[model samples]
Each structure stands twice: as C-alpha cells, then as structure tokens.
Target chain A: MNISDFQTRFGFEAMYDGYVDAEVLGGYTSDLLSDVMSKAGEASTLVTIQAHKNTVAVATLVGINSIIICNSRPVSAEMIESAKAEGIALFRTDKTQFEVSGLLYCALRDAKA
Target chain B: MDIPINTEGGSRVILELIYSLKVRDVMTRKLVTASADTGMREVQQLMRDNGITGIPIVERTRLLGIVSIGDLLKALDQGQMAEPAASHMSASVVTLEEEMPLTFAISYLNRYEFRRFPVLDKTGSLAGIITASDIIKTLLVEMNREVERLEATIAHPQTIDPAASPGLDPGSAGTPEEIVLSLSFPTRQYDFDGAGKASAEFKKALKQLGIEASIVRRAAIASYELELNQVIHSTGGVMEYILRGGRITIVARDQGPGIADVQAALTEGFSTANNWIRSLGFGAGLGLPNAKRSGDDFSIDSAPGRGTTVCVTLNYAAGP
Candidate 1:
C-alpha cells in the first residue's frame, strides 16, 4: 500500500503532503525513539504519539517513509516542516497507536496476498 | 600556518597523536648554545653557521636568555655588535616543559609570538627547543604511518557467490569497490535540534555507495544510537564516519562527565536521564545496546572524570 492510501482509506488527515508516495512495506508502533531506531524496518510506516521534530528526524534516519501521529497528538509546526523537508508522509489520526497499527498491518498483509 | 587542534572536528587519530606525544618527542635535542658574555658578533656567526634563526644564551646548561637574528640586526645597526649577548638577548622567555603534551606546545606556539620555545627538563635546565615546523613535520610522519597501518588491515573481500546467498540483489552482490569517505559532525549536549544529522548523512552516503539495503540499515541504526547518546548525556562530542575497504567505522567521542559504571550503563533499561529527557521519547537506556546489536564489532571506553568513546564497526557483507 502506498503512503497516500492511509489518508484515503483510514480517514487520517494529512499534515504534510509533499512526500514521494512510496509503497509502505510495514508498520512499527513505538513511542520510544530508541526503540524505533533499533527495531524499525526500512520503508515502514511509524505509528506513534511522538508529534515532534525529533520523531521526523528518527524517521528519516531509519528510512521510515510515513508517520501516523495517533490520538490526534497535536503535531508541532516544526514537526510538519521537518517531515516536509525529509519527504516523509505525515498523517494524524484520532485513533490510538494500537488501532492504527492493527489497521496498517491488515492492510499491508492483504496487499501482499 | 595555524595548526587547528580542533577537538570537535578533527580526526580522532590526529587528536590522539597530539595528546599522546610529549614535547620532548618532537623537540630538537641538539644544542647550539653560547655564553651570556659571548659577543653579539659571535652569536651572529653561530646563527649563520648553523642556519638557525635563534640561539639560546646559557651559562653551563642553565638557560639565561635567547638572542634572535632580529636582536643581532639591532646590535649591528647600533654599532654595538661587539657588545655582550646579554645586552641584546631577550630575557623572561616563555618556555615549555619537556614532559608537556604536544597540544600544549601547539597552544603555546599560537599564544605567544616567539618562533620557538626552549623545552625545560624536570630540574629546570634547558633540554631542547621546539618550533611549529617541528610539530608539523612529526605529525606528517605519524599520519603517514597510520595510513599505512590502516591500508595493511584492509581485509580481502569474501568470494561468496551471489547464487549461494538467496534473496541477495545482484546489483549489490559483488564486493564493494575501494572507496574512501570520511565525515565528521560536532554534536552538542542536549542539542535536540542537531541530533541524528550525522546518522542521516551516513545513511545517504551508504545508499549512494550502492551498499545493500540491510547493511545500510544496520550502519544507520548504530550511528543514530551513538549520536543520540552523545546529545543526551555528554557535554559535547564529535561523530566520525569512515568508510573504506568494505567496512564502515563510526566513532563517537565526547567530553566529560562520563559514565560512572560501564556494566550498569550497558544493561538494558539502565538510564541516567531525568524525567524531562525521558519525555522526549529517548532515555530508555537502549541506546548502547542497540548500537552494539547493529554493529559487527563494538567497544566503549568511559570513566567518571574523563569523557566517553564508543566505536562501532560495520562490514559490508552480512555476518554469518
């Protein structure tokens, strides 16, 4: 599934739309940046409540292509600017990280099938 | 030429060399001294014969003062060439200790206007003299030796057939060609704004080198964790990335205060960060472990009063 599909299918609002719309290989749900840095796979979507600039920095370093700030966690302007600069798709959802991760996993698995 | 002993941006090997080498190691031990009452004309003759710009005026190995070519010129202009060297020599000279680190000599050279400093031994007797040119010459020789040692350590690429490694991309299967890339980034303590920039750059460079994605990912993870560790805990530090001979080595060095306990610090979930830092999605105590797990070889050295140094080496080929 492409990064833009999250906004269209899950009704998540797009915070930054200047991304490459690359295919999302999978998803990692973590609020800890170290955990995300150590375990997050490349080209994955990050589902977390970390709505700050550092989160985008970690996403860029680890090759995470998309980020979904769950629970409507008030993403900062700097976060939006960083996401745009790094070409990472930024989305915000009213659902929790658990819900977003489940939905993303099923979607990615079904796409593989 | 100003020798920039840039601790924050210079190569670690050069920095270590300057810190490890003593002033006596590079100073010229051959003494060409004259008595305090020696005639200025004789001093001038000594300077000309030895091709030296300055000569230390001594009394039986006890340094009293130094007379430069400028002083001789002044004496000759004043028709006082026959005067004693003591009359024209500059006293109150700034001197360096023989046991002092080369870095001190470098700073002394920059701090003072003197072309050279007379090195004093433990008994306060003049032992040798050091100049900026001497430091530069020694550094060039040492750096050449270090480069040769590094080249000697370059391992031959493995001959694993691409077919044997399932799912290996043919484009990245062959041994990576010899390429040298060296980068340094200065990281400040609690500088959340600049954190991870080094690792991001490393990732980009590896991708451009056409390294396999998995290897690049591992290198990126190790670098990121190490960089973040410096930002969160150290006063300030530098991150160095060197890619050569199909291996990537990331070295992070910081200024004090260092870790108190190495074993405890490496344990999972052991963190010294306060509540505020923990709130920033860091300080979970996985930084070192994560770095170690991602790298093919890892070593960390830290002490309470001194700074910390972490080195992680990643190979291009996947480990067995």
Candidate 2:
C-alpha cells in the first residue's frame, strides 16, 4: 500500500511532501518511540499518538517507510524537517489512536489473509 | 503592503526585499514638503504640481503632520481649503526608519491603513517619503539581480561542499584497499520521544556510503534496539557506527541503573519495562534477543549500579 491509499481510506494529512510515495507493509501502534523501535522492524507501518521528531527517527530506524499519527496531534515544523531528512512518510489524522490502530490491524490482517 | 506576487521569480524578489532591502533604498529622496502655516489650497496645488498623493507638513526639521489626498478631499468638501494645511493634516502619523528593513515598513503600512509613511533618519530628521510603488520597484531590481545570479550558476555548475565523498566506484571488485566510515551520536535519558534518531541517521549514512543492503538493514535494527534500550533501560549513552570494508560495528556505552541479571535481560519474554512502555506496543522483552538476531556477534557488559556497554558487529564482504 502507498501513502495516498492510506490518505484515501482514512483522511490523513500528508506532512512530508517527498515521502508520500513510501510503501506501507503492515501496522504497529505505539506511543513510546522505543517500543516501536524494538517491535516494528521492517515493513510494518506505525500508528501512534506521538507526532514528535523522534517518532520519525524510530520509524526510519526500524526500516518503516511510513507512519500514521492519530488523535489530531499537531505535527511540529522540526518533526517535519526530521521526517524529510530521514525519508519517513508522515500522516496525521483526527481519529483516536485506538480506533486507527484497530482499523489498521484489521485491514492488514485482511490483506494478509 | 499585501503585494500579491504570483510568479516564482516574484516570490524570490519579495524574500530578498525582506532580508536585504532597506527603507532608505526604496524611499523617494526628492520629497514634497509643506509648512504648518501653509494654506490647505496651496498644499493641494503643491500635490497636484508634483503628481503625488501625500506631503509631510514640517516646521524646519521637525515633522508636524502629514496631508494626504483623502484629507485634502475632505477639506475641499468641507470648504476648508482656506484653512491651514496642519488643520487639515493628520497629526498622528506612522513613520519608518531609513535603516529599517523594507519588510517591516510593508508590515507597518499593512497594520495601519495608510497611503504613505514618512521616512526618518537617526537624527529624527525627515529623510524621504515611501509608498508601496517605490518598494515594489526596488524589489523588482533585486529580483532581476537574483535571476542573473541563478542563470550564471546554471550556466556554470560548481561543486560547493568539501566534505562530501562518493562511495566505491563500480568498475573494480578485487581491490584490497579498505575504506571505513565512522560516526557517533549521543543518546539521552527517557527521551522516549527521541529514542532512535541516531540509528536512523546512521542507516541513511550507511546507504549513502553504498554499504551492502543486508548489512545496512542489520546494522540499523541492531543500532535502533541498542539506542532504545539506552533510552528505556540505561541512563544515557554514546552510540558509534563504524563501517569498514568487511564489517559493520556498533558500540553502545551507557551510564545506568544497571541490570542485575544480564542472562535474564537477554532471554526472550523476560522484561523490566513498565506498563506505560507495554501500552505503547513494546516491552515484550524482545529488544535484546532481536538485537542479537540482527547481528552475527553480540556482547554485553554490565553491573547492578555503575553502567553497561553493548557492542554488536556484523561482518560483510564489501564487493563492487
């Protein structure tokens, strides 16, 4: 899945312009950045309430090409810069974290099944 | 002034005007002036002769008031042309400093609805008068210079940065000369928000260095795990990514409230992570085992209270 597909499925504002073409593998939800770093390794798209710069860092470190930030959290300018630098695609949504995580999990499961 | 610059070139010009252009550079030096005792009709005649809309009413060097076309029209309609120019002019005037940025003048003009503002020097003497037109014309000149510079650069491209080094040339493979890239990053405590940034940057640098894809992936995962461990488990640390022709090495040295049992920490499903960490989809006790999985060699050294250090190394063949 591409970032635009996620944008179409759930209304998400694409933060970094260049990385919008990043691929989505599956989804992992986390608020603590290290948690995602340890568990979300390669290909899994991350969903979280954390919209800070380090979230982008964790996603990039774990080899995740894209991330979805829930709860309408404001993406700071520094976060955008870091995401662009790390080449990690960033998405923001107004929906709560649990809702997005569940929906993404079901969607990924269905895709896998 | 809300000058709607639609073109890309125009936007560049506006940016230059904001940063480098000053009010004195754009203001009209040949200013039309009036005295307080001058008749409103005479002031209007002076404005008509000069084909200008505003004039500063001054006594010697001190600015007394400013008469605008709007004020003159009001006076003419009220049959007050015979009255003194100061009587018809606005005494509360907004002024700009000659040395101030043109952008500031534009914003000031925008803040209060005014046709023009008086430009003053450091000594509080009137230097000139500036309007929106004057500012735009100056911006156009600056834009032209920028366009010329860009054209020159495009015509003759130059390599500007000194530190950029390209990776291995693809033509040869059997060369024995070794190339190594070294990098270091400092990690902070509980900076859960910033946990793995260093690993991410290291991964990118590895990719740029044209390291083997499998090795880069392994190094990234290992470094990330170690970095997160530092943030969650250790107090703080320094992470170093060392890339040689045949291997990738990650050394993590951290200050800590050290672990009591190294074997338990490395075991699968044994964790010291709190509930908060678990709720965020981690603390599954997988970091250590996973870190070990990603590299061919992993070693850990720790005591209960002092500190801990972990080093992971993956040996790879660097072939063109």
Candidate 3:
C-alpha cells in the first residue's frame, strides 16, 4: 500500500502531502520516540500520538515513510513543516493509537493477501 | 582581598580550573624572610624596601612565624622597635600543602581572617606563600586563555581529513578514501522544539556521505538519544559529530548537575525527568540504553559535581 492509500482508504486527514507516496510495508505503534527509532521497520507507517517535529526526525532516521497522528493530537505547524521538508507523509485521525494500529494491521494484511 | 567568586555556583570552566589547579601553581615562590634575631626595625625596613606587607620568619626553610606591617607599626608605637621578630610575630599560623587543590585555598581564604597562607612542601619546608591576589591573577589569566581558545575554535571550525590525521595508519583502509565531516551543535535545556535538530543534520550529512542506510540509522538513533538526554538532563551542552576513518563518533558534553549513579542511569526504565517532560512522549528511560544499543562502542563519564560526557562510536562497516 502506498502512503496516499492511508489517507484515502482509512480516511486519515493528510496534514502534509508533499511526500514521495512511497510504499508503506507495515506499521509500528508507539508514543516513545526512542522505541520507535529502534524497532520501527523500514518504509513503515508510524501509528502514534506523538505529533511533534522530533517525531518526524525519528521517522526520517528510521526510514518510516508516513506518520498517523492518532487521538486527534494537535499537530503543530512546525511538525507539518518538518514532515514536508523530510518528505515523510503526515496524517491525523480522531481514532486512538490502538484503533489506528488495528486498522493498519488489517489493511496491510489484506493488501499483502 | 576576598575573591568574590562563589566556589560552588561558579561556571563549569572556572570550577574545573579551580579544582584541577594545585596550590603550588598559584603560590609565589620568591621568598623574602627574616630570622628570629632580625630586629623589628629591620623588619620595617624590609617591608618598606621590598614593598611587601608581610615577611615569613624562617630558619633554614623551616617556617617559624610571620611579621606583618601591623606588627612593625605596633613596635614603632610602643617603643619596641629594637625587639626580636619572634616576640611579636604571630606564631600560630594556618598553612596549606603545596599539592592541595585550589578549592582548599579558596575555602581557607573564606574561613580564615589572615590575608595569606604559607605553602609547605612534603618535607615540611616552607615552599611559597599564596595571597588572594595571586589566585585572582592566575584565574584571570587562565580564563583569558580559555576564552581565546574558544574563540579560535569558533573562528576555524574543525573539518578533519582522515588522511592528515596522525596515528591513523593509511594502509588499514582497503582503499584510500577521503572522509571529511566534523560538526558541533549547541543544545539548550528543555528546548524540546530544537532537541532533534542535531540528529537531523547528522542524518542528512551521513546520507550525503553515502554511508549504508542501516549504519546511518544506528548513528542517527545514537545521536538523537544522546542529544535528547542533554536537553532533558543537563543545563546545556554541545553535541559533536565526527566522521573519519570509516567510523562515526558522536560526543555529547554538558555543563551539569551530573549523574550521581551512572550505572543506574544506563539501565532501562530509569529516568529522572519530571512529569511534564514525560508528557511530551519522552522520559521513557530508554534514551541511554537505546544510544548504547545503537553504537558499536559506548562510554560515559560522569560525576555529581562534574559534567557528563558520553561518547558513541559507530563503524560504517558494522552491520545494523
């Protein structure tokens, strides 16, 4: 599934759409940036409530192509700017991190099938 | 002359200098002395001729007492100008060892009413004398030198070429490659907005250098964790990145209320961050451990009063 698919399929609001629309192979759910940095897979969509610039930085470092800011956590303009600069797709949702993670898991599994 | 510097709360450089410098470093070695039989009138002459406020009464380098200008004045007023130096000289004196740290001298100056202290060598011989003025002068000179060094570093930032670096054998590399990148960024305390800037810059530079993606990820993780540690834990500090010899070295140095227990700090799930800091999706106690896990080599040096310095080295050849 491509990064744009997360916005269209799951109805996640795209905060920054300047990214490359790369393939999202999987997903990792965590609020802790360090945990995400160490464990998140390559080209994964990060499902977390951490809507900040540091989150974008961590995603860039760990090869996370897209971030889904769950729980409607307020995404700062700086975060959107950073995401745009780093070419990482940013999205927001009213769903919690667990709900987003579950939905991403089902969607990724069905896409792989 | 009471030195107005607060020994406990002074800047890290000053505090480190004070603690590192010995009493002998700041003491006046040129001695002017009077014997027990030296007349009070002669003491007065010595004080006038040499422009000295005090003179130690010594016998073959053994310190006995000191005669000050005040004692000479008392002798002149009481018709005792002809009396021996020992009779009026203050016998009980507080002395400092030549090897004692400069902080001892500073504390002694604050504790004692005397203007100077006689510095003694290991053999119990009078080596020198230290006054407040001497300490002040030395510290000022050293601080000036330190400032100049910092300015020079700022003027010409280091971008080291691996070929020119000494002690690195060129034959060790499979192919002669020129690796050049050294950068430093200053990090402030609680500056969450600017916390990961250094790591982002490091990632960009590493990517530009054509380093392997997995290795770059490790380096980025290590630098980010260490950077965030400084922002959350230290007063402020600098994060330095050096890429040379097929290796990336990240150093985080801080002016600190240093870690009291470094072993516990390295353990996962041990954080000293406040509640609000934890609310920002940090303070998970995984910072140091994650940094350690990412790097090929890790070392941390810290103490309660001294600042903390953490160095992480990642080899480009090392697998993720």
**Best prediction by lDDT:** 3
Candidate 3, lDDT over the whole model: 0.86
Residue B151 C-alpha lDDT in model 2: 97
Q: For candidate 2, lDDT tens digit of each residue in B1-320? A: 56654321335445544545668889999988999999999998999999999989998878988999999999999999999997889999998878665665766666679968898887788999889888788878888888898899999998866322222324433557454777878775555545677887888888887877767887888888888888667656788776666778788877777889999999988988755445445577878888898899999999988778788999977756
Best of the two (2, 3) by TM-score: 3
Q: Write the per-residue lDDT of candidate 1 for residues B1-320, one digit (tens) a residue.
A: 56777633467667667766778999999989999999999999999999999999999879999998888999999999999999999998998878666777887777678888998886789999998899999989988998887776665445677643323234643556543677888776655666888888888988887889888888988998999898778867888887767788888888878999998988999998755567789999999999999999999999988989898998885233
Which stretches of candidate 1 lie above 4 Å from their native place? B1-179, B317-320
lDDT of 2 by residue, A63-82 (tens): 78788888888888878888
Q: Write the per-residue lDDT of candidate 3 for residues B132-176, one digit (tens) a residue.
A: 999998999989998998899899999888753323244745555
Name the best candidate (by TM-score): 3
Residue A82 of model 1 has an lDDT of: 86
Interface RMSD of each: 0.9, 3.7, 1.0
- For DockQ, candidate 2 versus 3, the one ahead is 3
**TM-score of chain A, cand. 3:** 0.96
Candidate 2 Cα RMSD (Å): 16.8
